[model samples]
Target: MVSAGVYLVVRIFPIVQASVVTMTVVAAVGAFTALITALVGLVMNDIKKVLAYSTMSQLGYMFLALGVAGYTAGVFHLINHAFFKACLFLGSGSVIMGCHHQQDMRRMGGLAKLMPITFVTFLIASLSLMGIPPFSGFWSKDEILGSAYAWGSEHGGAYWLLFLAGELVAFLTAAYMTRLLILTFAGKYRGNDAPTEDFVEDQAKLQSEQENWEIKKYDRSLGGLKTLYREDEEPEKHEEHRHVPRESPWVVGASLIVLALFGGFFGFVGAVPLGITWWQGFITFGHAHHAEVNWLVMGISTAMALGGVFVAYIIWGAKFAVFMRLYRTRLVQVLQAVLANRYYMDHFYNGIIVRGFMVLAKASRIFDTWVVDLIVNAFGAGTKMFAYAYAWFDLWVVDGLVNLAGYMWLGIKRGIRPLQSGYLQHYMLVLIIAAVLFWVVRYFF
Candidate 1:
């Protein structure tokens, strides 16, 4: 998320500010991120994701600007980028909605004429991203690069790499922006619409168009158009045709047109070469250091940017045979694999980091289960053993003593059985005999 980068930008700098080490770290991270996201943007099929990565790449540039002490330049681009980028994204959304929610570039083509307002506005935003001549993006980008060049020239070590990366990202920005424009709006209609000569028969009737995106010509790679592929292909399952795309409604188109105006001319707020300086004035930098656009850096950066646009046009719009072969090579295949996987961030996060944590969690669960059960089972086993011992004592020692007493009493009763006769005479004779015996004993003593 942009918030994460913003966190880094806001928090980390104040710890060690206006120093070479800070600048080096910030510049390195920003350049690396810019390059990575730019590559990812090149291979993105979904219209919105390409723009999203572009947004991230632009932020990286802002960081780079800050690192080089061109604080005003960064803010300048940020303001210009925010306006144009919004218009681009919203316009893309309109096209996607117009195309029955088809977001892939491969699924879209030849809508420029149909959606004139959206296309023109979107193209303006693309030019801003491309950093083409006389646009606000050009001025802002020129300032950043000029700042980077100034830093490198001022310090001739590996600091030059910052300038190099800045230039490289500039070109890449142009390439991806051009590619998006050409692929989305230049070619023949490739979407779910049936192959028909008339793209739009009646404008008013198209408001009631179908809202489905039918699948067709996906894996075959018609005329070398790159596809978002699913391995399965079921022609019978798909709807035969989709609705034709028309211009966006007035509400969507109006904002895009207005935003396009801002993105187109907002750079005039800060003159590129010290003519007018709104953004440069606002920079919180050393008061003594003033940045003026270096003519040399400006020429080179502008050329590289425009060259990127030319190269993109040659590859996608011109459809040169050489570019197609290059794309089919093993190197490009490997590169696509990398970009498509988003430089393997997801794999590292989901596969390695997440899996590692899950393993730890499962091990802890196993340990907790066994250890707690052992402690609990120890008490249960001890209790059961004591119960068994008590049962044994009750059955043998205590019960035996009681039974033995009972038997002795029973034996004495049996020995005195004849004395307990029912006859009264017998009972009286025994009493008299016992009395005489006792009298005699007492006299003799």
Candidate 2:
């Protein structure tokens, strides 16, 4: 919907002719929708839904670029969003599957210890989504924001407001993703139920079996025995063995390798065109279409994204500091509340849409059962009762007369039964007599 709305606005409203009023309105709508989607996703318990909402909000930033006619920047962001968002969603799915459908982060903790592959994958994706440098998201988001800042310089208050909002949303994005990681991987287990112990026992047993097999193979090789030997003939096995459950190193190593290649190559390619000359065929082609490098802008954008990561580390990373203790003050509590509630946007929507629908539903039910049904039911019942009385009269009086004619015909047939003969000719004559007798009886009656 956000993408469609943006495409519609860009196609219908010519950028050159659109007034500041139109641009501002389009930008606000896009930004607000994005922010709301992100906030809702953050609070959602379902992991997939959270990523879905995050996708919606991320696209809002892209749409904001389109609304401002930053087509290249928008496209760049769109491409980056695809990579990081897919990684995040899939990584979360992997975690959910590993944990046997436990998606509520509140119920999950210390998963990094159990499923390191999923944890590393999730971390890389989350960092990318947070717009960290060397990741795909950084280049694209920086381009979008840089364009916004440029627009802010020309368009007075509205564009500046949008730029500020984008910054705040960026901070929130980092904070919530950090919160997710901390709850899922950093803390001790806080769930109500304990994990099944059987899995641990099974893993231990498997490790022991693998160790015994390895030792047997080593013994066979050292003895210079080409043929297999019975276990009783093998050398004595060790009584104690260490159990180590390590993931295939290639899994984590391979993902990092791919992501590193993509992160380095995509940005360098995008930057190449800025420095190439016309004489340099391929290099010149890149330079012609690339964005002009503004060292100041790049520095500021890189600092913002890095600052977010640094802040996250200080609060929840491996070396978390105790700065949260200072937030115990009343003023700080109020500020935290405001941020947590998302500045009451959810409350405002609940009041307007949810409450309004509830009231409308109550009124509709009353109107349906009382006013509408009362009049219709009363009229229908009265008409039905009148028709039923008329039907009773018709059944007794009109039907009785018809039955009397049937009884007279029956009496005439019975009276002629005695005169009937056994022969065919005699029977035909008896039928004619009976018809004459019936006509006479009807005329006299």
Candidate 3:
């Protein structure tokens, strides 16, 4: 997934090819990333972290190749990287599991004898990644460096600097890879007390076996329940034990063996030095072109790789006491500190970029709470007030008018109600009164 960015940039090569500036930027970034990550890998203590940095460094190399318009070279390295890096990762896992989940190289050594298959497989993969000859990494990486140099020669100035950086990265990659292999599988074992889990598991198994044997040998009539012996006659204390590293199961070893074989010889598919062009033909994009192996570049790269291995062997393998003395120096300590801290890039991100984003997030929350919520609350209050006014008008003015009309009708009904009594005399009286009222009104006018 981390390499996806390089793949994406390569996928859009037409657009990238259109801009010289983009290509230069990609090359510059790749060279810088490759060198910096390799330096970081040099100081890493965890076996897996070393491999992680190695993957990044190798991805940087691929990007450098793509940036220089070496599409075939880039894709070739990508494929070769997959085989070797996967093997290295699997080999690391096998080591970790064999060491009872221990990953620190400082706590591991002399595992080659215990896990012979893993060591051989891991070494082959390491050699391939270091770009040693005959391995797939050597062919793929040599092509990338040659491409960088050729591109730079055509365009001088900072382009040359990029090529130089690529060379230096190759050197550092070998150094760190050799350092990892040595610390992990060379010298005397240093993790005698580190495998606590394995030790505990073995002790438990031993105790269980002892208890089961005792249960079968003794009769239950001699005691009660599962306890055939009295509490005072309990089992003796087990002796202390150290965990031993062992070879991984056949399933895992088989995968590593297969990948190691490819890592060792897969480069023959694109072995430019040997005039092999099958890989280039198969994975070409746009115009397929042949890559000629430059003897000078090949010689210098091989020397750098070997030189790196030699330096690492002296420092970590041959002269441990002398290296320890140098390691304790103030300058060396400071250099180690910088590399180990990844040149403080993590701190800058956390202190500045991350902090700035967090502050922005807090401000957004405040605005949402104060401004947005206030507007919504005010609108709600206004709507509620308008609803109350409408309720009051309906209850008082509108309903009162209707009630007044009803009362008036009721009063008139009451006034005329006595004339409608249920009697024949009452009806006759009402008719006589009506006639008298009519005569009186006519006489008085």
Candidate 4:
């Protein structure tokens, strides 16, 4: 949704007029979204979510291609990504199911023995995703790169920047995928305590100890660790053991079949034609044609792919592989650690965006509580006091004035009580006297 919003803004708003800027913005948004989604998915402990994030990241690459106007190449990649990504997700689901809800690769080892079919399917899908030769991903990805290079040549520096970013992203992608493969399939089982060879050994030792105890109970003076027990107290004899490595033919066969098919028909017989001529249009940007195969380019590409495989082998392949022991060196160990941490990209984001936002949030909270809320609360308290004062004034002063007026009226009624009697002559004499007194007082004044 955020990506779509950004796209719309960049499209409708005339401020961002440059095509290169628009494309760059789109690529940036896409890449950010992919990276965020992938990280979230990985942290959430959901197998499906992991795949979803991977798909999102892969789509980011496609969008990057499309933004650079490599439409055909991007579309091709989108299709292939969908195919192999689906296979990978489903295959991973199968592995989870076979492992009885163990989605964590850390809990799994030697599953190539227990769930051979799942392993093979997973291997193929992983290879395809890694862009191994003749797999679906290689063709599409190469096309994207070729188109990016062509665009960079046709345009100016911007396309070149995009191409460089894409290449860097590709290297990271490979590294992470390699890490995933190593942790998933190549390690020793590191799960919780269960039935293992160590457990079996401990159990056998315990039984032997119990048997020896019983023998000691019968024979008081058994010398040292070597004690011959009575017939009744003898340890139960167990059969001899032999270690035999088991192979899952079904899984191996399925893997071999797909790999063989992909190897033989990947470039030439599959969806995209694999011949030199077919790739010529892509590599040359539809400018040139060659009548014969270009073994040189093919060889170089193959060598690069194989080089990646060899690197992976050296780092995390079978224990007996010649260079495997060399990976235990300090330099290789540090390199692996760096790769596993995604070259500190996560740390960088956390330091910049996450920690920055956290600081802003804390500051906002303090401002709201101390500044804004304090001012608002003060105003509210003042308004409430003013209202209370008005109520007090109305209750005391206004009511006191009404009461005084009532008291005056009552006094007038009491005074007029005497005049209510039948005394007209007396009342006229009193009124004449009151008038005489009022005139005397007025003249004196």
Name the candidate that leads on TM-score: 3
Pairs with steric clashes in candidate 4: 267-274
All candidates in order of TM-score, best leading = 3, 1, 2, 4
Better of 1 and 3 by lDDT: 3
Order candidates by lDDT, high to low: 3, 1, 2, 4
The global Cα lDDT (0 to 1) of model 4 is 0.57
Which sections of candidate 4 miss by over 4 Å?
A: 1-18, 27-57, 103-116, 156-158, 164-303, 318-326, 329-331, 342-392, 420-445
Candidate 3 lDDT, 196-280, residue by residue in tens: 5644554465457666666668732333322533554322211124566789999999999999999888989999778899998
Least well predicted 10-residue stretch by lDDT in candidate 2: 235-244
- State the RMSD for candidate 1: 9.5
Model 1 lDDT at residue 22: 80
Give the alpha carbon lDDT tens digit for every residue of 1-445 in model 2.
4356545654555552257666666667767867777666545545676677778888788777665656566666665666666667666766655444445665566777866776776787777777766666666666667767777877767578777666656765775677678767776543434334743454355456566666677753322221233553321121122112233356544664465445333543344225522212232212343455555656666666666656655665554346666545688677655644667876888898889999999999999999999999999999999999889878887887888889999999999887665789878887899999999999998
Error of 3 at 251 (Å): 2.3
Point to the candidate with the largest lDDT.
Answer: 3
Q: State each model's CA lDDT, in order.
A: 0.80, 0.63, 0.86, 0.57
Looking at candidate 2, what is the lDDT of residue 207? 51
- lDDT: the better of candidates 2 and 4: 2
